[model samples]
Target: MPEETPLHERILDTTEQVLRRYGPEKTNVVDVARALGMSHGNIYRHFPNKKALLDAVSARWMHCFTESLSTIASDSKVAPAIRLRRWFDTLRETKRKKIQDDPEFFQMYHTIAKELHDVVTAHVAELLQQLETIIRDGIKAGDFHAKPGASSAAMAFLQTTFAFHHPALLVTRVPSDDEADTVFDLLLSGMIAGPVSKKLRPKVKKS
Candidate 1:
């Protein structure tokens, strides 16, 4: 016998399909309910309202990205420098691929992400905490001499790479792989143990 999908998951799955079909502007609870072959009230039982459902969907989507990064962050076998590089590159690549691969779904979640400000805020906080962990590991490994505490240094690193990580900016101004690599090297050099030479810094091209 086939096992039935959980009701809550069914609603979320159907909602994603509906969002892909009708987009954020047009998708509603009723559409999701219809797609799931259930009454609107049934969806409401799991998700309070249309906005709540969309918020859940947005959270789910963002978590997927965070989970991927978390795996890299927790990998102790990788050197701090290489792990940091992979983390940044994976983040930028994952976001870019989402938009390029399924623009409709990306646009839908991007809209919901704005509407659910707290969700986005908490997501950023969680990612920042993960970055702090990575920075602390780098310090313990004698890779970074970040004078500021790990949390502060992590926040600064995130801010400096804002265009690459921030969702709204990511859609329009995501850095190229070469650009990310150059900026990462410059930033890490400043935070690395001991003195960094001028030769390590890449010269900025004139516009």
Candidate 2:
């Protein structure tokens, strides 16, 4: 006798692949069930409808991302600098597998009413807030620059340097982890560049 595969997990796994390839519009229960080697009727037994399945998948993804971030933040064995770097690194990595890459996702959902779009945007906004909290803590500890407001600085850094999300902005002959670390250090410290000193500007002492 064949072991029964769990319906919810199968649906979500299928949805991930479908979102990457086809996006939301083409992600019907029949297609997902076909992917899982099950009948469409069987899939409906797990999820009431396609929209319910889509919403559940999106929610589950959010929980996973948040859980991962929370675990990293609480890991005491990691040094603060390494942890800080990890924060940006995780953001970069996540962008590679993001909602934006799923064309069918955007296409299918965008065609719907604005409510769906608003929900997606709100989810992202919440994640941004969670990361900003970490940045604020770093600032308070004097490890990160706190001049330009922690939230603003964190958003700027993520938006500007996260290569996975904004690949076009990432200019470099070599894009390695070491290279990224060096670049990030320069950006963070160079932000606090000191003012030019008039006395040190090749000035002759007045008699």
Candidate 3:
């Protein structure tokens, strides 16, 4: 016989289905319990409230989304520049695919994200840490120049590419792959260190 799924996992799985059907606003513990054939009190035992349940679901989704990128970020075998570019490309494509394949889940995620600021904030922080790792490696390899620190450079990279991966912007319009590549190239050019043509160098104003 196959091992049974844990009650906690079942609750989260059922809660995701409920959110997909009714969205975050209408979803509640009772809905999840009804779907799972359990009492709402049982759900409270696993998750304190609806917000906590939503947070867990959102965190799980984010973990799935970030897992691949994490692998790319830590891949020392590849050049940092190449890995960085691949990271952003993967991030953009993942978000696009998620939206295309399951729009209801995507919209539900957006609604939950708005209500659960802490969960969103934690997710962003995790992404930044991954980016920072890649950037610090790049600096060590002399592929990039970040004078301040890897953390700040990582922030810059994320903020610059927000249009491609951010849920709100993606919901409004998904940029073409070519457009995302162009932006990544532009951002990379600024960070990469080495001999550069005069035109590519930033001109400084005389004091």
TM-score to native of every candidate shown: 0.85, 0.57, 0.89
Task: Give Cα-based local distance difference scores for all models.
Answer: 0.81, 0.60, 0.86
**Tens-place lDDT digits, model 3, residues 20-127:** 788778999999999988889888878888888888888888887799999999999999989998899899889999999987778778877888889889989989
Write candidate 1's Cα lDDT for 60-141 as tens digits.
8888889889988878888877777888888888888887887666766887788888889989998898788888999998
Q: After superposition, how far is residue 134 of candidate 1 from its true place, in Å?
A: 0.7
Task: Put down candidate 2 lDDT per residue, 9-90, tens digits, no spaces.
Answer: 7788897777656666676878888888888887777777887677666656555555566656555566545665676677
Better of 2 and 3 by TM-score: 3
Decide which is better by lDDT, 2 or 3. 3
lDDT of 2: 0.60
Per-residue lDDT for 10 in model 1? Answer: 72
Cα deviation of 36 in candidate 2 (Å)? 5.3
Model 1 clash pairs? Answer: none
